[model samples]
Target: MTSALAELSEALANVELTVPAAPARFLRLEFLEDAPEEAAAADVWSVTLDVSGLDAVPAAGDTVGLLCPNAADEVAAALDLLGAESRADRPCRLSLLPGTTKKAARVPPHLPEHASLRHLLTHCVDLRAVPKKPLLQALRDDAPLVMVAAGTGLAPLAGFLEERRARGQRAPAWLVFGCRHPELDFLLRDELEAALRDGFLSRLDTVFSRTGDRQRYVQHVLAEEQARLARWLVDEGAVMYVCGDAKGMAVAVLDEVVQTVAKAKEVPVSEAKKLVQQMQKDGQYRLDVWS
Candidate 1:
C-alpha cells in the first residue's frame, strides 16, 4: 500500500507548472508642507505621495498610507543583532497569500516579490500608514453631506469637497471645522471660505478652542445647530461624517448628538443613544477617528 504523498507525487511526476511575475509599485514624495511655516495652519504636516503600479489612483477622500523607513544605521544595528548583516540585500521569493478571493488584497501592492530589506525600506515604502486601515466609505453623490472635523481631520474631507465641486455638484454641503487658533492653526481657512463663496457649501462654521469664542469646540457648534441638523437628517436626507481625535473631539461630538436626539424626540438618554447607534448601522452617520 503506497502512502498518499507518494501516490500524489507519482500521479503527476512529469507535470510542470509556470507562474507569471508580479509588477512593481513606485512611490515618489513630491512635496511637504509644515504648519509652522504657513498662516491659518493647524500644526499639521502635509505630504504628497505619487503612486504608480496600481490599477487606479486613490479617488477623492482616500489617502494612501506611507511608511518612513528606518535609517541606514538603525537598519545596520538591527541586522547586527540578528547576525545576518550579509543577507541584508538578498532577494526573497514573492507569492500571494493562499486561498484568497480574486479581489486580491492590495495593502502594499507596489512591492515586487524577492525583494530585500534595503530595497523595501529605501525604495518601496512611502509616506506612512493607517492603523487598522479603517474604511470610512465614500459619500453618496445624491445626498447632501455634513462634515465635522478639527485640525488635520480636515485632510480627507477636503478631498470630498473638492471632488464634488469638480464634478459640478451644486448640492448643499456644510463644513464645521475646529482648530486651536484662527490666525495660527485654522487649516485651509481661505480655501474653505472660497468654497463657501462659490455656493458649494450652504453653510460653513468654524470654532477655535484656544480663542475667546462662544463655540469652544465643534460639539458646541453642533448644539447651536441641533434644530437644523435634526431637520437635515429627518427631512433633507443628509449624511453626517465626523473625522478627528478619537479621544476628545470624537467623544464630545457624539455626546452632543445623543443629547440633541434626546431633547428633540423627548426620549431618555439611553433611548436616544440607541437611536444614534441605529443611525450608524443605517449609514446615516459615519465616523473615521484615530488616536
Candidate 2:
C-alpha cells in the first residue's frame, strides 16, 4: 500500500463503532378525571411510554426525563447560535465532547454510545428514567402512608397505589386528592374507585375546589382528619407525603398538618412545626413539589 493509504487504513482500524440504543415508543395517552370535551384532551392527558428498551425496569415512583419539542423561538435561537439556520433538520451524529460522560452530561444517561441527533430525539432518549428524589420514594410495605396531592400531581402517587396492588397491599394507606370539581378534572376516578374497592387504598378522600357553593381543598380534608392524622404520624409511624403546587396547595397542607399535630399534642404551633420538621429529617414526612 502507498504510505499515505497505509496511514488512512491504520486510522480506520482504530475507529470504534457501537450499536445505538433502541428507541422507546409512545404506547398510550389517557384522558383523566372528568372534564368538558374540549378540556379533557388538553388539560388531563396522561401519556404512557413504552420503555421496554430501558436497561432497568422502572420501579414504582420513577420519572422519565422527556425532552419535548422546543418552542419556535427556542429553535430559532438555537439555530442562530450555531449559525446553522438552514440546517435545522440536517442529519448529525451525537457524541460526548472530551472529558464528558453520560453521568456528567445533560444527555440521557442510558442512551447508546452511537446514535444520530435525529434518532436521539425522535426514537431514543424517551425511556431514560432515574430514581425519584431520595425524599420521595416508592411505597413501603411495612408502614401506613398518607398521600396528599392536587391535579396531575396525583400521577406519581398513582404509581404508588399500583405498586401497592401488584405487591399485595400489606399496609393501609390513605389518599387525599384535590382538584377543580368532581365532575371536571377529578383525574383517575375509575382507577381510584377501584383501588378503594380492592383495598389498595384504605381510604380515599377527594376535595373539589370549584364546584359547589362551598369550595373544598385538600387541607380541608386534613383539617377534619386531625386526630387520625396525629395518630398516623405520631403513634403508628406512618409516612406522610405531600406533592403538587408549592405556592398554594403544599403550603396550605403543611400548615394544616402542623396545626393538627399541635392540637393533638397540646403544643404550640411553633413547636409543632419543629416536630414536623423533625419528622422530615427522620424521613417520615416528605414532599415533592413544583410551583
Compared with the true structure, all predictions reach lDDT values of 0.79, 0.80
Model 2, position 203, has a per-residue lDDT of 93
Q: Write the per-residue lDDT of candidate 1 for residues 53-168, one digit (tens) a residue.
A: 66786778675654666577766776677686898788865576787696956545667776886666556654233456456666777888888998888988888877778887
1-291: candidate 2 lDDT, tens digit per residue: 699999999999999989898889868888876545435333668798898997889877776565655455555565577677665566665566887645757644656566544444445533334444554568557889999999988988999998988988758799999988677687999999999999889999998877677778999999988888888887898999898888999999999988988988899999999999998898888888876
- Candidate 1 residue 278 C-alpha distance from true site, Å: 3.2
Give the clashing residue pairs of candidate 2, or none. Answer: 34-185
Question: Lowest-lDDT window of 10 residues in candidate 2?
Answer: 122-131
State candidate 2's TM-score: 0.68
In model 1, what is the error at residue 6, expressed in angstroms? 89
Candidate 2 regions with alpha-carbon error over 4 angstroms:
1-42, 69-135
